[model samples]
Target: MTRSPATPLPPPKARRRLRETAALTQTQLATRVGVTPGIVRAWESGRTTPRGRKREAYARLLKTLAEEEAARQAKQKQQEQQEQQEQQEHQKPDEKQESAPAPVPKLEPESKPEPQSDAKPAPEPEPEPRPESAPVALTPAQAFDALYAFSAPALVRQTFLLTGRREQARESVERAFQAAWERWPEVARDRDPVGWVRATAYEYALSPWQRFRPRHRHPEPPPADPGDRTLLNTLLRLPPRHRRTLVLYDGVGLDLPETAAETEASTPATANRLLHAREAVAGRLPALADPQVLHRRLTELASNERLRAAEPPAVRRGGERRARLRTRAAIAFTVALIGTTALTARTAPTHYEPPVSPGQAVRGVPHRVAPGALSDEELELRQKLRDQMQDGPERLLPRLE
Candidate 1:
């Protein structure tokens, strides 16, 4: 018997979208497919692919989800069309009456103009000159400055919401813009330059390392309003991931997919975080159960605080300075490395020298003896001299001899 081919799955993003639309967590899908949640995550993230039976099960599940989503969207579209038709029907009579042509004025006979030779025609006003129609192209620096000006203030406010510290918020926005300026080509070509900067700012603002900084160790003063303070406290209490998801989705008015993409998380995971974040906030302040209310509260909280961003020229100059410092440091390091290498090559030994072998004792060798103890004759002679030393003159004459 021949084996049938395995079923194919959709792309990673689509797979994730399908799972999220079906409201299935990675674990839940993993359980049905007899695999680990990590495996399911990997599949959705495009790190791995399923095969054989698991592939078939996953494919079937996704196919069902896709069909359901399609049907739901179609139904939604049909409902929208019906609403439009109803609106048109209701507007038809008014539109017809408005479209009716105006009544022609009565044709009265005109009287001849009474000629007054002295009456001068009113002086015709000269037309104002029109300005140039073409748009002015911006230099790279000017373009970056414009982007920074347009996005920096609001981004600072948003970063403040992300991180409760005003100083860090401003710093984060400045650093993000600096980075954008450094990569202006890539940023300019991006479909959403604002989004690129916003993502960078959010990442920096929400960085885990920020918590370790001594300056950020202490929380900034809370908003004066009790409601605003409560809302902000609740937001800060949330995990960073959930807080960011909540901010992007509810506070910044991003859709689920956009938030997911920005946060670099799967759609289902993003939804889960958003749900948990909402629950946490709602649990604290029941009044914020509505997303619109939460968004308004977020806006009010951000606006209540005074956060200002650096000037665009200052930011651009700072970026350039940083880039120059890095380049110089790299060059210095390379020069030092090359110098060390050259020195080593120049001073290194040109040839190998044989090592001296250690000496060993011979088996038959004897230790050398000291000079024989004072000779017997020398001792006798010394005794004789001591005995015969009668006269000093004789001793002196013998010494002369």
Candidate 2:
């Protein structure tokens, strides 16, 4: 069997983003990836993609470079800040001397206060001995119930931000919860079930199936408070991965590593995405560029009732049945296809030969016969030719005598 030709990898943005996130110049990336700078440019331009192991090497190297670059930047920033602090201290000797700690005043000779006889202070109530019984471990069902109640709204909100559609957000969140419910036995023991659910919901929200779904009859987006609309618009405008990372990082309050886990990306990549996302948001809302200012804004965005997964699921408790049906249908279809193909092959012939009529020449073939073989017309013509040849010599000789 002939193999299908290998197609190029997807999304020119992937290689470009990696290169940018790695903080590598084109020439540097080329040298590191063992390609010419022109080839790297072509990869970024979508004119070509690295094939086979080179593609894997490219991805691995980019991640490695990004981590290294992040470390370098952190070290550099720390050194610069330390040097600046030292310079400021050295430059301000007079100010430092002038700002010396004030001297403590000597205590006055001790004078004891007299107790008031009329006002007896009420005895402080003895602290109740807290019950020391180890807290009861919750059953998985109870744990899931609590998790679902507490995290569902925020999960739905983050998912809505990622997907930009409330209906899809609700669906994704519901699916995530349903999956959690099925796996509750194990998830109850998880360190962060809420994170697990939120991450799962994000994945569901980004499902490719969502792209093919009908968009008609969407519930209208409630009017956003104009105060937050600018941030909302900026978030929505970002690429899905970046937008999802931002929501998980700032909006969901996950730190870089936690956000990376949620986004199924490395910490460095998540940080890079978060940086770009913050910059995009800061471009629109300059106040958010500062860490203090952005923290306050993100706090408001995180708790904004408007961002709450306010809408309840349209339906619940049906996914399992639907999943089973889909599974069975897929198996049946595969079996049927295989059976039909096998049966047809068994019934087919190895080769084909169609009947031909006499005197009809094959399309591209000339008719030929053995020399001894002749038709009646050919025989009669040959005999006449022989008789003429035999009579010719005697008739001519008599005429001459």
Count of backbone clashes, every candidate in sequence: 0, 0
Residue-level lDDT for 365 in candidate 2: 78
Model 1, span 1-401: residue lDDT tens? 99887786786668887888888887898898899877887676443468888898889988999999999999999999999999989877654434668899999999999999999999999999998799988999999988888889999999888888889999999998888888888678665788888888888888889878899657677788888788888998999999999988988898987787677676778999999999999998999899899899898898998888889999999999999999999999999999999999999999999999997878899866886777899999889999885675543334553
Could you tell me the TM-score of candidate 2? 0.51
In order, the Cα lDDT scores of the candidates are 0.86, 0.69
lDDT of 2 by residue, 87-198 (tens): 9888875643456678999988988889889988999999999889998988655666667778887676667666666677777888877777666665565556776677
In candidate 1, which residue pairs clash? none
| Residue runs of model 2 more than 4 Å from their true location after superposition | 1-140, 182-186, 216-219, 302-316, 338-342, 350-401
